[model samples]
Target: MSFDQLASELQVRKAASLYRGRKVLQSPQQPEVVVDGKAYLAFCSNDYLGLANHPAIVSAFKQAADEYGVGGGASSLVSGHSFHHHALEEELAAFTGRPRALLFSNGYMANLGTVNALLGKQDAVFQDRLNHASLLDAGLLSGARFQRYLHNDVDSLTQRLSKTQARRSLVVTDGVFSMDGDIADLPAICDVANHHKAWVMVDDAHGIGCLGKTGAGCAEHFGLSEQQLPILMGTLGKAFGTSGAFVAGSDVLIETLIQHARTYIYTTSMPPAVAAATRVSLKLVQTEQWRREQLTSLIQRFRRGCEQLGLSLMDSPTPIQPIMIGNADKAMAMSAALRDKGLFITAIRPPTVPHGSARLRVTLSASHTEVQVDRLLDALDQVK
Candidate 1:
């Protein structure tokens, strides 16, 4: 437990090109941003709909702040559950086509609280191999028999489900894989889960504000009913352009979380202003078909450009496009080269991804222009 061991590990990470660092952003969350005193056209943000700095959402936040003041003051079980919080939960339930929805401080807490509440040592939890770190951590902490299936392979999930003899089984996956940008086969997964009598939970953090005709998320996109996806979790900070996360499910599921989810029961509720702002964001997500349309156009344009360049790309049809680079050093070097070319895209290295699957994660937004995407393609071509 000496400090020298920690220092040695840091050195090893830096040597392996796996050390992570933060870039100070001097501007708002948008396509054009100033980071560390330099301006660049950024493609690394999760703001898929370009609503982070939207006027209406910002105005709503300010107005709610003026009325409700700044802090949450207490946990939801206490006096902190504001009118905005309650109203947003109801709206989210309707939007997600569920009986009820409960809010959490963020996506991590939502996942941690929900899984732990639902399962115990007598139960079993199965997750996709490529699930987010939060989901993986939640499963580990749940003290349940944990198993990971092959990424997005329904047969793998079904085979594992058949072998598990736990009293209860829960299968979890991300609606959209954050690193590879591919979507989950929700319909197939749901069918397998139904056959096995297991519950299906989808964390649609990256899919909520970008998919579906009305932007209700992957469940809506796949036309899955509440019974098909019993526990659905989505984050507001991504496409919704606000903060916090929520779980939408049946009344019993939600009530169980409210009572048993330590992360929800202990933490201070999200600020009322964020809830108010997200209310507006939710409305925009539903009404504005153009945002999704624009994102689709950009995704297609970028993919075609990469294909023309003969660059290796993933099977993602979503905004999160990744350029496959096998070596960690090469991924980091390519990211540095892009930064030098007046563009910003992060190199995703292990263990964020698997070993030897390093990549440049290129996220698109409705705020990005065709010309900007072309510039990114040009940079990739030059670096490659």
Candidate 2:
């Protein structure tokens, strides 16, 4: 209740090796950036397709700003629903092959809005143990009987589904685990959700614009029908290189969310210019199949190289490649060693991830060349 209590809390965080910090980036979000007066090739950004600094996206953003101005002055429930937001929703609906889509300010908001809107006191929410923090928080906020199934374990979900007596059920998971770099078993989970009559929602924050043949996220990558993964959440800031998020689903679902989602009802909408820019990026993401191809090749290259160095890596097909360096201190040591070698990567530690699984999350982007990946592999050889 006092300032000393806050200071003591910060001290406890420091002692627990979980104090977080931000780096000052002097350059754009690209393969190479200037951070803290030093230039380094960073592998920590979420810009999977490398369009964060693409000329066309920049031009689109600038042009839209000229036409639409900045900021949505009111919430969408009032008068802030502009043409740009509507168009982006249409584009996203078509992109994900869903009947409708609803926009939220960010992936976090999208998850919270969707989860809390659909399930309340009478319903239950089941989630994968390793789903994103936002999903877990959303479930808690929903006042449902929130339960976490074993990570990516379909049998666990089946057992829980058979036992639960809640009137309505919602099953949630990350299409790709944020920190572990492993994918959820979508096919198995879908089967369980289908058999149990529970609604399925997937937070594909890290999957969109990085998976599928045309960057349609994990549902498309796995060839699952929209009916199979009815509630899909995709963020624009990651692979699309823009800000905001959208939920794609059946028309009834979108209508319900537009009426019921508290986050969407109360908060100001995303800028019209951001929607305009994201529209351009979405087109490029859908048309540019080469980006996913190259990114996959790079992930494979890095995995093979790490294997040769006897470094353990997670089983992931996406851009998130987390090396399994066990101890927190050693993970920090390895991250520092790479930083000194002109490479910038964050040392992921507990509460962001589980203790002893702390390691470097080596993210790949379409902007990075094969040679750059090989150089990274070579530098990592030093750790071996």
Model 1 stretches with alpha carbons more than 4 Å out: none
- The positional error of residue 266 in candidate 1, measured at the CA in angstroms, is 0.2
Query: Which candidate tops TM-score?
Result: 1
Q: Each model's TM-score, in the order given?
A: 0.99, 0.98
lDDT of 2 at 42: 90
Q: Write the per-residue lDDT of candidate 1 for residues 212-317, one digit (tens) a residue.
A: 9999999999999998899999999999989999999999999999999999999999999999999999999999999999999999999999999999999999
* Model 1 score (lDDT): 0.96
Span of 10 residues, lowest total lDDT, candidate 1: 1-10
